[model samples]
Target: MTTNATPRLAPGPRGTFLLGNLLDLRRDLIGFLRQVSGEYGDIVRFTVAGFTVHLVTHPDHLRHVLQVNSRNYDKQSHEYRPLKLAFGEGLFTSDGDFWKKQRRLMQPAFHRQRILALGEHIVRDVVERVDAWQPYAQRGESLDVAAEMVALSMNVATKSLFSTGLRGDEEVTTIARNLDTVIGYCLYRTMVPFAPPPRVPTRRNREFTAAMTSLDGIIYRIIGERREHGGDTYDLLSMLLEARDEETGEGMPDKQMRDEIATLLLGGYETTSNQLSWAWYELSRNPDVEARLHEELDRVLGDRLPTVADVPRLEYTNRILEETLRLYPVPWLERRAAATDSIGGYHVKAGSLIYISPYLTHRHPDFWAEPERFDPDRFTPERSADRPRFAYFPFGGGPRLCIGNRLAQLEAQLTLATIAQRYRLRLVPDHPVEAKMQVTTSPRYGLRMTLEPRRPAA
Candidate 1:
């Protein structure tokens, strides 16, 4: 409603006069941005890839831009186009009416009830994965926790979203692996955060396209089967196929279906994987926190597999995961452009872009004391009441908030607790825990660690 041009919140000096701080951001993105927050205050500006962006740290301003008054903003299509090539026109990137229809129709699949019903399967599958890791422990092999988390999360998505038939399908792995590259390539590489189109057909891009082809074939066949069967199944695909207008009965078309699958695969896989990796990293660092997590699990399920009902009681494990996300948000920052005449008193040119960095916002000194310190206690009941709602936005906010938010938390809590109940991971000596600020802020060197088996309960 108001647009104030704060001369105080201005862009930095880097790159070329025209080019801006593009290279600076691309070089060491997290460090550079953190330094920016330290130097210029939270709500400042900088250039990247020839675009001017406003970095907002104030929770109120962010809530305004992302949620409260979000009609003025939409998902950055300039950003989503690369994904469009892989996903078509699905939810993650699509805008306006089409996005609305897809959002509403897709709602039931991720409904709280639906996700809770599938929670047992999520807990069980994760336990099996951890059991498989016992051999790695036996061989005295170090672990790439990042890759393992990705693999686990991908399987979780398959189980809950796709149903039993799609779980562990060869085509599904190909899709996930291909998407792993595409996300890191396109969203986290350039100073401006985009991957260039393949010009002469390099091995990386070719592999992505090939994987997409296989995935598309699988999804297409599934959609075709859904059409033939006439809305018979309650799985995600059938939900989308049967989704209709509240007033007019119209289902999502093939193109939208393709985009949604791509969106889900990309958005679903990376964020959860990165979160689990970081949680493992933190758990390795803080043995005290890990022990407490173990205590909670021991008291709760006590050797039995966790049920959906047990999730709410797994509060400590969930807090550890939430704290992990606060330290290392997968997306790092979300960019959007103004759709209307203004933001506050500033005359936001219709096409002007803006950035709301949860990475920066989360570490605000005012909201979080000793912000850089890793303290999960902030999430405890009394302390959590001290902050505003959008102050910690790992899954983002608003109607555009991640549809998979609850589902992701369910998987993380269940998986980490299930693993902690048996095996404990020790940080490997001299291994660097470097973060790659790519599509998601993944551990660049991979989270290499040693595993120790817990003493069995008497």
Candidate 2:
């Protein structure tokens, strides 16, 4: 770990002579990373398109990159450049003083009290959505759980962001579809190093542009309306408009507001939805976990709707979410070395890409016993006390940690409790459930499930 020592690259797979690990990476991102990290150890170094990349998986190493020496690692890298197409210079892709300023201005919106208030609306919304699933349950028809969660999460995110949900199901579907297009394109660009720029007008580029335009039109229209007709609103949009920089006493400009809003919508909606989709899949596969979840709901909720006050008592429900995140972390962490550094006794050059996988770290045998098991008890205080903090960072860590972590958790916890109270989601037989790596982790093939009603809807 001493920087003064002679520099040495970390051990890693010896890929192709010309392309290095590019083919392997593009073929299977998550699987490739997991294989290399498992084979070569924590600080695995490899080349992709002539770039020296390091896959750091140890908890201590992750802590160094994410927290202790976080300043040395930042998002100003090629990995984040593609995201700028959709997110612009928002918190997700922005760095340095600007990111700090935005984070400060927006931090209050996600505070404990703010999320608590939002939790009530989230639960109500989830209850209505879950009730709507009754028809499908009664018909015994398989429902695409992935799409369902995306739509539900979009509604929740829209409400939290604007204090009003999307106009209707059509608009929600349209916006969600556009978001997928733009995000999928961005991910494609990131993975394909030599892909054409946006200006090149490739078929995919055109689609990305169209999707972005649609999204921008909707977002700008809302911002304009909100600005012209300012009202007493408790959503994040209103807060951003009202937020004044402590140093300059200036409010966020429209462009900045748009970027931040886009970031939140993308971050909050897709991540929560994917996590929920996976949660249902896991629940279906593990009836024991589902039974315990139902037990907790019955004891704590008892045919009543869950509220923010009940969140604490729904301990098992929260653990399920934690376990899901551990198994399949969305938008896995990536950073570029801003300067030369030493990690896990290996030298990391400036501009070297550092990839950390919560998926892999969560499964590290040293820290997690039977790491692949879907046991929520792994997150219990007694069990987790000895684990490293970075061993389970689905939302990341450090100053750049996700601002809406609490809100996302609350949304998932309440939505799960609400739905579990009414029905159990069982994956359709012979259905293949494979994790797809996009802007966030998602099911490669949409998750289709048959819902079994547990009790009559209220």
lDDT of each: 0.74, 0.88
Question: Poorest 10 consecutive residues of model 1 by lDDT?
Answer: 187-196
Error of 2 at 329 (Å): 0.8
The residue-by-residue lDDT of candidate 1 on 365-433, one tens digit each, is 889899877788889999988688889988888888889998888888888877787788887898898
For residue 11, model 2's alpha carbon misses the true position, in angstroms, by 1.5
Shift in Å, residue 390, candidate 2 = 1.0
Q: Which stretches of candidate 1 lie over 4 Å from their true place?
A: 1-15, 48-50, 167-169, 188-205, 229-234, 339-347, 455-458
Clashing pairs in 2: none
Specify the highest-lDDT model's number.
2
Q: What is candidate 2's lDDT per residue for 76-103, written digit by digit as tens? A: 7767988998898899999988899989
